[model samples]
Target: MNIVVCMKQVPDTTEVKIDPVTGTLIREGIPSIINPDDKSGLEAALVLKERVGAKVTVLSMGPPQADLALREALAMGADEAVLLSDRAFGGADTWATSTTIAAALRKLGFDLIICGRQAIDGDTAQVGPQIAEHLSLPQVSYVSELELAGDSVVVKRTFEDGYQRIKVKLPCLLTTLKDMNSPRYMSVAGIFDAYKKDVQVWGLADIVVDEANIGLKGSPTRVKKSFTKGAKSAGKVYEVDPKEGARIIVEALKEKFVI
Candidate 1:
């Protein structure tokens, strides 16, 4: 089996800051890490590789800093890593990002594509399905359990109500949740090896991507405005007897028209 895992480098949630002036994420000088849920997806790919003796390749799309995430994957047992970076890819929304990744996947040709259910920062939960649509591949999202049976893939997918088991053919896309697996830590030797390993970097031109359908110009949605979520302090707390506390709660509710 030839498996591909899509990973992302995201800003540390606590360190992330939004530029009030440009209405964009301020990434300069900020710490970056692999999206947490993507670690589970990478683990799933590694497990699959071990079970089926497959070649696992990790792919990521981001700025040059994203090479760090790829190197980390290499240390975690991925056979190879590919970095897709270009200035033209900046400010792309989920649609454009998915399109770019799908095109890259087409170039690589894979039997399966694994990705996190959603990125930590964005949490849009749209890219995986969007890539599936772009590739015209069968897709299952929020997968918790996965198994390979002959040429088919069986997956347990989580929905609002509960989980549903489904089977899909090869060349499918699965977006995995954190509950899927526990990611293994990289060994000291693996870390040292990854330090000397070279990650393949590809640009839009290298992938032979159409300029019109990728990056900022190819995106239909534009960021008309961007702003950081306002900080909110905790509300008041009351100290009183049970009866007094009930009265206070009622009064506050009435004041807010909640009663």
Candidate 2:
């Protein structure tokens, strides 16, 4: 099996900022890391490779700097890595991102596509389903377990309340949850290999991407504004006897108009 895993680089949540004028994420100088959830997806891909000795390809789309995430994937044992980088891909919403990624996957001709359940920065949970729709393939999101059957894949999906089992044909897409597996740390040898290796970079023109539906030009949703929430205050502590504490807290609550 040929497995393709999609990953994203996200701003460190604590340092994320927004451009006052554009109302978009101000990514300049912000520390970046692979989306936490995508690490699980990467681990799932490696597990599949171990199970069936499949070839794994890691794919990511972002600015040139996103090569960092791809290199990390390679260090985690992916066979090949591709970076889709172009100014035309800038400011792409999940819909446009899914479209572009789907087109690239079509060119790749893979048996399976794996992704994280959601990107940490966006947390919209739209890209996986959107990619499935664009590629016209079945998709299972929030998958905790995956097994390859004859010409099909079995998935165990997790939900807030419970889990569900589902079967999908080959050439399907899967969005993995964090509980799927623990991501393996990069080996010393793998780290050296990643540094020496070269990743294939594809631009918007190389992918024959439609200019009208990509980048800032194609995005429909607009962020009117974005601002960080102010830090919360630590409440005052009162020390008292257990019985007296309850009575005192009740009086304080009423005094504070919180009753």
lDDT scores for all predictions? Answer: 0.89, 0.88
For 116-198, candidate 1 gives per-residue lDDT tens digits of 99998889989999999999999999999999989989999999899899999998999999888899998788898888888
Candidate 2 lDDT by residue in tens digits, 1-259: 9999998988887787766566667778889988877889989889879988899998999989899999999998998999998888888888889888888898887999998999888899899889999889999999999898888999999889998999999999999988778899998999999988889999876785688888777887777775665547897787878999899889998999999
* TM-scores of all candidate predictions against the true structure: 0.87, 0.85
For candidate 1, the clash count comes to 0
Residue pairs in collision within model 2: none
What is the model-wide C-alpha lDDT for candidate 1? 0.89
Best by lDDT: 1
Residue 246 accuracy (lDDT) in model 2: 95
- Scored by Cα lDDT, where does model 2 land? 0.88
Q: Candidate 1, after superposition: displacement of residue 48 in Å? A: 1.1
Extract clashing residue pairs from model 1: none
Model 2 shows how many backbone clashes?
Answer: 0
- What is candidate 2's TM-score against the reference? 0.85
